[model samples]
Target: MRLSRYFLPILRETPKEAEIVSHRLMLRAGLVRQQAAGIYSWLPLGQRVLSRIERIVREEQDRAGAVEILMPTIQPADLWRESGRYDDYGKEMLRIVDRHERDMLYGPTNEEMVTEIFRSYVSSYKALPLNLYHIQWKFRDEVRPRFGVMRGREFLMKDAYSFDIDEAAARISYNKMFVAYLRTFARMGLTAIPMRAETGPIGGDLSHEFLVLAETGESGVYCHKDVLDQPVPGEGFDYSGDLDAAIAPWTAYYAATEDVHDQERFEREVPEDKRLHTRGIEVGQVFYFGTKYSAPMKATVAGPDGVERPVHSGSYGVGVSRLAGAIIEASHDDDGIIWPDSVAPFAVGLINLKPVDEATSAAAEGIYERLTKAGIDVLYDDVDNRAGAKFATMDLIGLPWQVIVGPKGIASGEVEIKRRATGERETLTIDAAINRLVAG
Candidate 1:
């Protein structure tokens, strides 16, 4: 994407309303625009990042054996009534009524709706272990929504529902999602620790929240410091094999959010030197709420001996859009967001230091074409902006690699290569620069 043709409405100065670094950088980088108090219109750059994040979530979900199926954002209230959460869900639920006086709502979560759908067609133990997932927008009426997309009222979410015939089978399904979340976050360059969490309105005794530690996080968390460095189960993990072995160490660790924290136990179990009390951002959550929604909503399947039984169910969630801000909070420096290559808006930024100069433009254009042809996403600075402004824009957007093309360098048949994260620069021949970036 060329800067001149792109709709990058970058702000020259920071917006006063943005309190956090991600919020400020997002505004200054022209990634998003506030449509209302907590609602945002994702601009070209933000949309691209969001799509990349969604794709990772989708791929991981598929690898974990979950089939994809999109659900409606607006759901009938009858499903909620069946699950008895219609009145219990409280003010965060956006309840509504359509013409003819029928009640509806913009779903905050999809437990009841998914249960209703599962019961409609699935009816046998043979199809017992089924998982359905969707990536969609959810609305919650946060009375005071702030911190940009991090705590937005309307945001994107990747929610997956698993249905099994009984407890043993359901537990296996739960573990699959547990490992999948680890892989998903790892692929995005995040180390997410799974901590036992309060299930809130989801109403599940078995629940775990995946947290990414950041100083500016909303929840206070406590855990062993070494938990941060534990290795996640690799891609070769057998989903159908014993998943308990894979989840055992992660589950046995001493970790909990503020709502479930036990100070006395923490003092007893963890050594003083190894204890870590910190703030955390909840990026993902999984729940095994046996018969909670299924029984109430009549999501039953026939047993092998021809008996009708409520299917045990579980729900998994990853905060798709909030992750963008959370990632920046955990990874950014003074300049701007330092995006993980997997979720970066563009892999390489092609900066022509002298955009108006013929030689620089030609060299930058040639490199951009070569990179694009090699299936790389490159943001070319083809606009007639000052050298400092171009460099600032490239750093602010935080592409992983930057290729600098100037008249002097082009005259010598060389271009500069810079890694955004390390701030390391290298001068190389034009061919060498193209080869390095394309190979990368």
Candidate 2:
């Protein structure tokens, strides 16, 4: 992508409404533009980051054996009614009437609708242990939607629904998602701790919220320090094996959100040196709501003994769009966002420091072509902008690596390679720069 042709409306001054660093950087970096309160239009740069995050979430979900299937944003009101939550869901649910005068709603979550899908075609123990997921936009109409995409009225989410024949099977499915969430966040350069959390409107006794610790987080959390360093299940993990033992090391630690925090137990379970109290942003959650929606909606399956019973079910959710903001909150510095390589908008920023100089432009174009040919995602800043402005813009967008091309450097037969996270720079030959990045 070339900045000359990109639609990036970067702001020089911070917006007054942005109370958090991520929101301010997102605005200044021209990632997204607010259309209304808590609503935003993701610009080209923002969309690229969003797509990368979604890709990681999808890949991790697939690794955990969850099948992907997209569900609609607008859901039938009758599905919520059958689950006895249409009215109970409260004002957050955007209730509407269609042209035919039938009630409809923009789904905030998909438990009721997924249950209807499960009941429609799946009806036996043989079809048990099925998990379906989708990445789609959702709306919740927050009464006070603030903090940019972190607390937006409309957002993208990856929600996976699991169906099992019994409680034991449902727990195994929950464990699978548990490990998946760990690997997902870790891949994005986040150490998300799984903590015991209250099942709010989702209505489940068994639930865990994965939270990334940040100073500006909305929720207070308490946990053992070791939980932050615990290793996640590797790629070779067998989903068919005992997932319980796989995640036991992480769950054994004392971790809980404020809603479920037990101060006395926390102190007793963790030594004073190991105890950690901090604010954290929730990135994902897993819930085992056994027969909660299935029983009420008649989602039953025939057992091996030929008896029909309500299937046990669970729901796993990762805040797909919110992660972009949460990641900024956890990873940004005074300069701007320092994106992780796994979810960066582009792997490298090819900055032509002197676009007007024939030698510099040619060198930059050659380097850009080489990187792109090597299957790397590079954003070529071929625009005629000042060197300082170009550097600021590249840093603001936060690509992992920046290859700086200038008349002076190119004349010396070298290009400057800078690491965004560490501000480390090295002058390398064009070939060396390409080899280093390609090998990365």
Residue 192 in model 1: lDDT: 90
Query: How many backbone clashes can be found in candidate 1?
Result: 0
Per-residue lDDT tens digits for candidate 1, residues 1-440, read: 89888999999899999998889999999999999999999999999999999999999999999999999999999989989999999999999999979999999999998888899899999997999999999999999999999899999999999999999999999999999999999999998999989999999898999999988788899998878888888878778888888888787779999899999999998899999999998899999999999997888999999999999999999999999888888778888878989999999999988877887888888899989999999999888878898888889999999999999999999999999999999999989988888788
User: For candidate 2, lDDT tens digit of each residue in 1-440?
Assistant: 78888788879899999999999999999999999999999998899999999999999999899999999999999999999999899899999999999999999999999999999999899987899999999999999999999999999999999999999989989999999999999899998999999998899899999999998888999999998888888878788888888899999999999999999999899999999999999999999999889988999999999999999999999999999999999888888989999999899999998888999899999998899999999999999888899888888889999999999999998999999999999999999999999999
Cα lDDT, all candidates? 0.92, 0.93
TM-scores for all candidates: the values are: 0.99, 0.98
TM-score quality measure for candidate 2? 0.98
Query: In model 1, which runs have C-alpha deviations exceeding 4 angstroms?
Result: none
